[model samples]
Target: MATKMVGFVWAFLIIIGIIYALLSGNISAINDSILTNANKALELFLNILPIIVLWTGILKIAEGSGLLDKFSSLLKPGLSKLFPSVPKDNKALGYISSNIVANMLGLGSAATPAGLKAMQELQTINHKKDEASAAMITFLVLNTAGVTIIPTTILALRIAYNSSSPSIIIIPAILATASSSIAGLTLDYYIRKRNK
Candidate 1:
């Protein structure tokens, strides 16, 4: 369904763009636009790829050094409250904590592996494999909403663009993410309560 929706939107946009370009007698601009956007995408990828690689390497080191274990331990108490359905000794908690930490620091690429591991662990505990469990739903809500602290990717992009004050966005991003996290948690809690 989502794939279909995306395809529909893309087709609609392309059709509209072509029609507008022809009507404006700037059909040549359509080809130029495509080429320009393709170049911009490549330029953007080149700028962000290094940051992703560096952070992914750092995450690997953290895991190897047992830093992730310590970090997970620190987050365990609070995580238990948020994910009460998950067993206290569950391995998923560690991965969930690691995923959250990586996301906060804006290492989304690094977080993916841990998040996948977490989901796999969660599935083991799920009695109904067909439907999402409460814990899984809560975890997904928190993960998707994000509680970004560093916003490293955004900062990196800003730097690439030579922003006057790249770091200025840090506080705002933190506040915004915090708000989203709060709202998401609140809604999840309310939904769980109502369901029960």
Candidate 2:
């Protein structure tokens, strides 16, 4: 549904742009913009690809070295409290921990596989397959309001765009994400309590 909405929005914007360009007798500008922006998009993708690959490799190394397991264990106590429905020894918790850690470092592309695995594991324990379980909803909220510490992707984009001080956004990103995480968790807690 969200994908459809995004597609509709892009289509609407493109139609509006073309109509405005025609009305303004600047249709050629639209052609130039399409070509230039496509090149810029490709350049941006190339610039970010290395960073994503490096981080993904690092995450894989951490997992292979048992570092990720150690980190997941450390997070388990709190996670257990957050997701009481999930068994303490469940693989879902481990995947959830890994996903959160990856998001915290701003490695969203690397986090996707873990997140998907977490959801799959959660589904196995879900009694009502048609509806999202409480744990699933909570996880969704947490993931959406992820507390990012590094903001690596944004920093990479800033560097690619020639920003004078790419790291300047670090503090603000941390504070904002932390606030969002806190608010989301608080709201989820209340909703859960009310449901019970």
Instruction: Write candidate 1's Cα lDDT for 3-104 as tens digits.
Output: 999999999999999999999999998989987998899899988778767866877888799886787679879999999889999999989998887787
Compute the lDDT for candidate 2.
0.87
TM-score of each model, in listed order: 0.84, 0.87
Model 1 segments more than 4 A misplaced: 1-12, 23-26, 53-61
lDDT of 1 at 121: 97
Stretches of model 2 off by over 4 angstroms after superposition: 1-5, 24-26
Whole-structure CA lDDT of model 1: 0.86
lDDT of each: 0.86, 0.87
